[model samples]
Target: MNQEIQEYNESQTTDIKDVCNRLAQIIDGNLPEAESKIWHRHPVWFLDGNPTVGYSIQKPGVRLMFWSGADFEENGLNVVGKKFKDASIFFQHVSEIHQEDLVRWLNKSKIIQWDYKNIVKRKGELVRLKKS
Candidate 1:
C-alpha cells in the first residue's frame, strides 16, 4: 500500500478502518500495476493516469467507488452517479464485502474505463477508453 493511503486507512475509526484496509488490500492485489495515492482527500487507484477505483469514508459507510462503474453491468453497485459514469456501493462492515463480487467488479474496472484523465481537456466530455 502507498504510505499516504496506509496513513489514511489507519486514521479511520476501527470498523471503518477494517473496511478501508480490506478494500486497499484487494485493490492492490488485483490491480498491481495501478498507481495508488490520496486523491481529492481519499485513496484512489489510477490505471495509466486514469482513475479506476477508490474508497472513502462517508456518512452512510465506507464508499467504494469506481470511476466508470456505471457501465460495469453489475447490480451490487447500485449508487450510480447521475452526472458521470461513476458508481459505488456502501459497506457498513467488513463482512458486507463479497470477495467474489469485489473481484469481479475490479476485473471489470480494468476493461471498462472512461477518459477521466483528460475530462477537463475535453470540457467534461467523457469518451470510452476500453470496453468489456
Candidate 2:
C-alpha cells in the first residue's frame, strides 16, 4: 500500500480498520489463498495479483465492492454508489453480508481475475471488487 492511500484510508472513520479486518477474514475464510493488500485507499483481495475484492469504511456504513458481481444471476446482493454499474456490490454492515452470496460472487471474481489479468490488474481503475 502506498503512504498516500494509507493516509487517505486512515483519515476515514475509526471503524476503517475493523471493517478492513472483518472483510479480510470473510475473504480469506471463503477463498483460501486469496492475496490481500491496500489498494485505492481500501483493502483489496486478489488472485494471482489481480484484484477480485475491495472494501472501505464510510461515515454511516462500510462498502464492499465486488468487481464481477453484476455478471452473476443472483440479485440479493446490495448495490450502491455510481460505481455499482460495473459489476460491484456494497454492504453497509456485516449483518447484511450473505456468506453464500459473497462466496459465489468471490468465486466468479476469481475467475474474472484469472481470465483477464492485465485489464483488471490496476488499482482505482473501476474493475469490480467487493467493497465494505
**Which model scores highest in TM-score?**
1
The TM-score of candidate 2 is 0.61
TM-score of each: 0.96, 0.61
Q: Can you give the lDDT of residue 114 in candidate 1? A: 92
Q: Tens-digit lDDT track for model 1 on 33-128? A: 999999999999999999999998889999999999999888899754677999999999999999999999999999999999999999989999
lDDT score of residue 8 within candidate 1: 99
Candidate 2 local distance difference test against the native:
0.60
Which candidate's lDDT is highest? Answer: 1
Each model's C-alpha lDDT?
Answer: 0.94, 0.60
